[model samples]
Target: MIYAGLDVGSRTIKLVIFDTVVKESLITETGANPLRRCREILAGRKLRRLVVTGYGRHLVASTQGGKVVSEIRAFAVGARYLLPDCQGVIDIGGQDCKVVRLSMEGDVLKFEMNDRCAAGTGKFLEVMAHTLEADIGAIGDLALTASRKITINSLCTVFAESEVVSLIGRGEETAAIALALHEAIATRVATMARRVGIKGKAVFAGGASLNRCLVRLLGEKLGIELTVPDSPQLVGALGAALLAKHEDGQ
Candidate 1:
């Protein structure tokens, strides 16, 4: 039997199909309108069960009879399934960030989330990069070449952009400013993770994990080694699919 999971996030949508008997998986992404895209992706495919998760999950119609899972719970399950030794998860999406601490069995121990602001999320980096006239995709590599840390004092995205512009006016190297941005984001996320008390092996998920500079800075700030899954952004969908199979069993 095949189980399907859909994670409809703010910036992107992800889908994962898991085969029960063979334990194989297929993962894909659809930029927006997740519900419609999911339907189109699953056309003619026989799925034994389906689950939905993420911030935009409620937008998915209940008429489809798919089970709805919280993004936090789904991430916990996905992290556990992929990295059985994982004890915590740090997921930084486009607009929000979450730090989840789990027991050895993958049960939630504690968690903290920063959804009210974009300071610690991917959007902040995107905006900063745009302000610096730098490519978002190249920020990581550019930051690595910096010789000094340029401080970004503002946690507010608007104020931070203005700060970056001011730094540019001062003839600061973009690399230094980029390093500062990543460090700022790392500091914000690390502070949240400390509230829940990071434990054991940690797994970093979501699109931001793809940023090497952010990952290194975050790990350094948290004082813990972090692991990234093959496809960090798909972890939620994978968990949803796993939940679909578990639900089918009951």
Candidate 2:
């Protein structure tokens, strides 16, 4: 069967087309408008089922005649499918951070999320990248080469930008400051994960999970090796696809 999943995230929309019988999947990302982009992507596809998940799940759910699943559930389902031993998931997106505790069967046992601020989200890194005049993709490599550890006093993106400026004025290298920013963000996210009671064999997902610096810092703070999906950003969509597959069996 051909199943389609749409993840309508705050900053971007993701689509996944899966051939369940063959266990193959195709993923794509577009702007935040999931309804429009989903229709555009599904135009020529012959999908037998569809499911939606993520921040804007309800918005696309109605249009696609599909059910809305929580991002935590979807992420856990997708992560565990790819890494069956995964017992925890940490997802840091554009606007929030989520930590989900999962059972051996891939069910969500407990979860915690921080949607109240931009401090620990991908936006934090984006703002910092702009302030440092550094490429977001290169930030990780630059951070890895830092000679010293600088403290970032503020977790607020605006305040952090100001702190970065002050550090630059004090002759601190951009690489060091950037590394500190990533470490600060990782600390916040690690705290959230701890609140949910993280276990070993954790999986990190979402757009920010692709940031090597943040992932490395997260691993260090959590003191656990994290499994990253082949396409970290597509976990939600993959989970949605898995949901569609289940519904078809019913």
Candidate 3:
């Protein structure tokens, strides 16, 4: 029997299927109708149990039957499963950022979240990448090659976008500007993590965690050796899947 977990995130719809014989996950754009996209993804799947989590958890739960878990709890469970010694989780999603402190048993002890603005989330990077006329996937690698570290003073997405554009017009290197954006986000997220008192063995999970430059900068700013799951973006879904299995007594 397969246990499925659906994570309806702001920018992506992630699905994970777990069972005694196999473990798999899939990612798709959330698009205009997330519930419809999710239905299409699970069209023919046979699930013994289902669990939903993330920003759109309630929406998915209302249209589908599943246990609901907070993103904080889901990340903690997913972190522990991937990094057995994990004590903290930093998840930077499309529109929000979360710093979760976890217990040895995978319970969420404490967490700090930034949901009011897009300054330190994936959307921030997306906008920066667009301003620089660069691909989001390549921005991280490009940032790593910067010879000088530039500072992005603005904390607002709109101002930051304008700043990036101005810098480009002033002949600033794209690489340096990209790194600055990552650094800015890392600093903001690190501050939030410190508020919860970061512990040892921290993990970075979420779509933004896929940015190598951001992950490195975040580790440096937090002064912690951060680890990323093979599929960081799927961590929440994986956690939900694990929850479904337990809920089903499978």
Among the numbered candidates, top lDDT falls to 3
In terms of lDDT, which candidate is stronger, 1 or 3? 3
Residue 49's lDDT in candidate 3? 90
Instruction: State in Å the error of residue 130, model 2.
Output: 0.2
Regions of candidate 2 where Cα sits further than 4 Å from its true position: 21-32
- What lDDT, from 0 to 1, does candidate 3 have? 0.89
Query: Comparing 2 and 3 by TM-score, which wins?
Result: 3
Residue-level error in angstroms, candidate 1, position 231 = 0.6
Those runs of model 3 whose alpha carbons end farther than 4 Å from true positions after fitting are none
Name the lDDT value of residue 162 in candidate 1.
89
TM-score of 3: 0.96
Q: What's each prediction's TM-score? A: 0.94, 0.94, 0.96
* Clashing residue pairs, backbone N/CA/C < 3 A, model 3: none
Choose 1 or 2, whichever is better by lDDT: 1
Expressed as tens digits, the lDDT of each residue in 42-96 for candidate 2 is 6777878888898878877788677888888888888887899889999988888
10 residues in a row with least lDDT, candidate 3: 16-25
Tens-place lDDT per residue, model 3, 1-250, is 8999888998999999999633778999999999899889888888889999988899888878887999888888878888998889999999999999887776788899999999889989998898888999899999999999889999899999889889999999999999999989998999999999887889899988889999889888888889988889998998899889988776
Expressed as tens digits, the lDDT of each residue in 105-129 for candidate 1 is 8899999988899999999999998
Lowest lDDT 10-residue stretch of candidate 2: 20-29
